[model samples]
Target: MPFIPHTDDDIAAMLQTIGAPSIEALFDEIPAALRSGERDEIPPALSEQAITRLMRLRAQGDEQPSCFIGAGAYDHYIPAAVWQIATRGEYYSAYTPYQAEASQGTLQVLYEFQSMMTALTALDASNTSLYDGATALAEALLMAVRANRRCKSKRVLIPRALHPFYRRTVRTIVEPQGLELIEVDFDAASGQTPVERCAALAGDQGLAAVVINQPNFFGVLEAVDALTDWAHEQGALAVAVVNPLALALLTPPGEWGAAGADIACGEAQPFGMPLSSGGPYAGFLCSKQALVRQMPGRIVGRTLDADGKPGFTLTLQAREQHIRRSKATSNICTNQGLMVTAATIHLALLGTEGLEQVARTCHANTARLCDQLCALPGVERAFSGAVFHEQALRLPQAPNTVLERLASEADLLGGCALGEHYPELDDMLLVCATEQRTEEEMQRYATALATILNAA
Candidate 1:
């Protein structure tokens, strides 16, 4: 009976404790139309061996050749050491360190992750972690409103070139809070947000924040200093969502001005995490010391233990959901611990030089791919701008049809089509080339794309 985990008697007893006759009674509040009216066709049970075989067959059918998709998730190489270390039982099963003494190791890793993020963003402080880049941007906008004392004129300006998901996330979070979301146009020629136009828009709105992505969604780096100054003059906070790996070659958002960015947030998937079909990735949020109090997630701090030895503790609990309840800075309950640990270990393994090498290879590989793609008959750069690992190109034919042909006929993943988001870019394809991409891979991609276009 115990092997069943929840026997009929146990379920009845539990339901009795809750004053419910049956499980169906618990769902009375749910709308009738939304509830499932019937059961699925799956068998009630199967032997362990049969289940294993069925799962394996399904997995085998799902496997495909190596892909080149990088709309946001990338296909970079993850070292064996990353999985080897992360899979250790202690780390794999650990929960949040509510008590610092019992969680010294986890706390220390979080503390180090915070430190590493600070160095990467060149900011004074960083929280342990966030849900992901999109949520982090949402939290950052909320933090800006908090820092500005919930001014009615609080407006957050986002660049058109920022990740589409991040834009939607911010809108979702801010609109409910009565905060204004202003979308600024990017220079179509350069794929960069025109700071002058942004400055002109910032006039007297009591703007709370201005967000721009470095090596933006199109992979074009924005003029951070100009944008930062413009935002500051309008009494607004400057937030930059940066690519963690790209920070190795470019100046961090923190270095844009004297104290750097008011808040710097970005996806940490490039570190050691996998695409895993777009998640579960980690997001990092960093800010100057002055604004550390306004950071949404947990903050790990160093302290001295009873033995007078250096120890780590989760500091700044006042900013979290438990302490503040509905009044908390953010309702983000769980920090992405496993992913954070992987990133910390990955960064440690790379050190300073290794990160730079990764960044350099990304740039070089992208440049090579861009050149080859541009030489195709009807393919051209979408924007005549400097870029990093990803670039956009205009194709003569419909991007979606061309992409389908590339995948079906040429056995390629092809590039992300832009028509879904930008109507004018119906024929544009967004492609990315990382360190994992070789010269041969680049050539194959170009040849496949060109062949598809010519045939079409």
Candidate 2:
């Protein structure tokens, strides 16, 4: 429906019908200071053409930097058709599929998204979506505590090598709920959380879950099979925090160990979404079939309707909005519907082989970029281990300083500085090269970095 603002006459009529003297009278219960004071507070309305021109001018002023920074969110090539289909009238405006009979299209899109996620992770089931990767892991931790009946402890072992932001988010979300998140340090040489470290904590502590991030925060691959099995041996659920794109090339969490990970969750932004500033990204969470009821958010299922025709509707919704608050698995009210829609469309367009090819190209490009950057004097790989795409490098000069020079002098984004997050790695920079990055762009970055270092 198009927006139709009320005119003075319309407002007055509505006010009279409601026994209100004016629109202001309706908000009399609110404090006068809190109420909007002036019409000037709002920007002046413009014609459609005028607004388009204004937006174009504003966009022109913005710098379109070639981004190489992929801590969690990534820069991947999005097909033109993905958004074209996703933003169609029905899909774009749809929110939660509260009315199943009337929302078959929306429900089916979510159903496909879940199906794809499960296939990507090799898990049994998946939720519709979540706020983002960070919050999704938080929800996964909470679910782990609930689903692990054998382990009575609320303690969860989180690797320090996991994304720092995700760790903080999990703490914020689960700490108040009486969950204990024990930090397990990563090996300095490998940038991986060694299974032995987790083994040390495996006695009678009764851990609820252990988080394993494949191609961890530093982009160094972890011993997932060993770690997954270790968690199982401890009778704790293995919570795998993964990169959805990397899963195309690496072992899926469900096939991680002898038994496999119980839960797998990660950012699904690379599937289609752009790094608009930072986000509007979606998170995907998948788990074993036994834990489906404990998984937060809705799950869509295909069924035969009264006419014996195929239909899609919400099969399981564990959020507080769907069930009794006390019995609810999570308080998350809704999924990132629009982003999920785009991702589903993207996956359908790409298929399995296309996605695997993208992942392989990203890995190859990143490897080449790393080799180029490391060839320069006083730059070396920060950690020694296999990586999917991203890599952390040690530079002679301060990373932030070099990054500033790269951005200003060469019009390059360079990469993320690791000093602020890991003080021990004060001279390190984390860089990534997705399939979007070309040979010329990588060479440009290397030349720019070498120039900056030589000048220093």
Candidate 3:
């Protein structure tokens, strides 16, 4: 009666085989006083139409807002075909390629994704994917430390202007392994990490790596080429944390220095993935081919079987799941495959030229929005450096209070406040407008902030 898979006879046979009289007899060793005495409080099933109506009513309770916040996640416009094609029965899956033959489609899609990323980063190789931006950054830092055989110091220079969340994550992952994350200061005025400070670190022996954020936490573009060169000169590996979209306009990390950055990694959410309450997103890591084995996560490669037909298979799977934990490059077991599939479909449809336009449009929209917002009486640019799609702005009062006022009183989701992550910039708010934001929406945001400022 209880929806058990086995019939009474089968249950009896199983019970007899297990030396139990009945199902209740199996729990004889357990104390009755601690057991749940009452049935779960579940309502009776509703009619289909009633269920649909009820769901609609519940959905109406949430007021979906036009997104304006882009500290790390941008609200880029996703084309209809991106998800439509990606969700096709064969493509929509959450499985990693454990079986080479059965997973050719999955493996091929991942391989393609890798190729696209390598081309984008101008690096020789890319791993399949990682969990998120933070973990990928953690792995990249660890990779640098592992690769630096000559550099005795396991100290990696992290810029103060790097995203606070990422910096924290790196510290959590690396510090436990006895690797030090040294904070490098940025130029106070321009919000860019000073190359001179990095050069100064070079004099200190045993510097393993330097982490440079292009279009850093304040959304100010750092002098990447200079920073990369400094790291290389110090005999330290340069790990460039960058936004994938901005690479369309700025120099790719692979081409950043005289020798280029040793590693390139960043968030891939802007590539047609929704900022679903800060993800379910993917992080991508790319390195020059020389460090391919050191790259964490999985790699899919094109190959030929005995028939000499081209096929896809998992290659360079350096994880605890594949090898022993001690030998694994990273303990990161799985990847955001669904999101990667979404991104692959998204990029394939957009192509190189289309993606370039999307990047250009985001920058253009943010620039226009920046001009309008800064024109407000109490609002001003927080930094002098050029930005791509986001920037930190000086506000009249604490940004948290102002952002709260805007969101509740005006039904608007304002940009991220800097006070919590960046106490030094207590009066700053990181604002952004992607290509998805219209001129009208931008004006409304500015107007809302202006009204709040005037009231103060």
- Candidate with top TM-score is 2
Q: For model 1, how big is the CA root-mean-square deviation?
A: 4.3
The residue pairs that clash in candidate 3, if any, are 153-206
Q: What tens digits encode model 2's per-residue C-alpha lDDT throughout 342-411?
A: 9999999889999999999988998999999999999999998888899999999999999999988878
Model 1, poorest ten-residue lDDT window? 62-71
Mark the 10 consecutive residues where model 2 has the least summed lDDT: 315-324
Off by over 4 Å in 2: 5-54
lDDT of 3 by residue, 329-410 (tens): 8877778888899899899988989999999888888788889888988789998988778888998888899888888766
Of the pair 1 and 3, which is ahead by lDDT?
3
TM-score, prediction 1: 0.90
Error of 1 at 396 (Å): 1.4
